[model samples]
Target: MARRNDHTREELREMALASAERIIAQEGLAGLSTRKVATAIGYSVGALYTLFSNLDDLCWQLNERTLSCLMAAIKEVDETDPVACLQGCARIYQAFAEQYPERWRLLFEHRSNTDNPLPDQLSTRIGGLFEHIDGCLARLYPRIDRHERQLRSRILWSGIHGLTQLEHSNKLFLPDAMTAEDIRIHLIDSLLAGWDKESHHA
Candidate 1:
């Protein structure tokens, strides 16, 4: 292992995070460890602790990186129409999950230690992803209250999240006729229709 003085704290943190991501990508969360990350980055496990509070902290940072990447992917969707915006974000989300099953799964599956909740910046990045949907719903229903729009965002996100989770676990294979995209489109359309009905009644 290299001496701690060999690398600045920022460089060590970046190196550790990069190594941890690769481990999760290749071997899943079960294979990621401070020791493993340190070894891969040619540093001591102590170096990781200096940068992160604990293993959970390390995972939290890893999730932040994943969220940032996911947000970038979602942001690429065009703002043509509300339905298209929702569908485009959903499609990009599914593509990200499929492309990096382990890394994507880490965002949802890894839990931070209850004693030390995730940092504020990490929470902000996670919330930023939802903001994209919230913005779409706001445009979709210009008259809806902010709170209502927030609820709509959560509802739509839940639908897409559930679909992807099921697809990832192969539970989406019960009926062989439909592809994942087919289900995704159906979910978005159905959600929009339901919201429209509710909006009309309101």
Candidate 2:
């Protein structure tokens, strides 16, 4: 009976999250409220409080889940070459944004002003992606100092994130402008070129 109860609770939590995602997808973040989520999930507001302390907590939970999914997708790449791995990571990141625009927006668009730290699990999940990029840099430029490597990694992450945001938001499509794929490929090439130039100097 205890096991069954636990299972049911887990299901309810999942349902609540699903309903929240649906609401966000349909009407954006402004549409997400405790009362609306409760109504959408056919649960009382008190029931939502059982799973999440407040609507902000629910938003954080959703963002964490989205990041987890993105990290998982990136980790699935099996390329052996370091440069190829980096490119693969870029492709996967773009794919995630294109495939899950709403979730992507929640993960990157919604700025949180709170001083609250991310849960350790979510931090580790995002850290893994950075670690992977750091590993590639180590292989590409073995003589670089730790500080230099960190700087390069941050640059790479920011470049990719910016390009992904532009492409996903359809901002790349100006009058007689490039397609999303064109922008993605160009950004990836530019990043690879920059890395190659840096490695030559290093």
Candidate 1 regions exceeding 4 Å error are none
Which candidate number would show the highest TM-score if scored against the true structure? 1
TM-score of each: 0.94, 0.83
Q: What TM-score quantifies how close candidate 1 is to the native fold?
A: 0.94
Question: Per-residue error at 101 for model 2, in Å?
Answer: 1.2
- In TM-score terms, candidate 2 sits at 0.83
Error of 1 at 39 (Å): 0.7
* Candidate 1 backbone collisions, by pair: none
Q: How many clashes (backbone N, Cα, C below 3 Å) per candidate? A: 0, 0
Itemize residue pairs with steric clashes in candidate 2. none
lDDT of 1: 0.88
Per-residue lDDT of model 2, residues 1-202, tens digit only: 1222444777878888889989888888778888898887677788778888877678888987887787888778775888878888888988888777887888765665576676677677777878888888888779888888888888888988888887766775556765655665676568768878877886
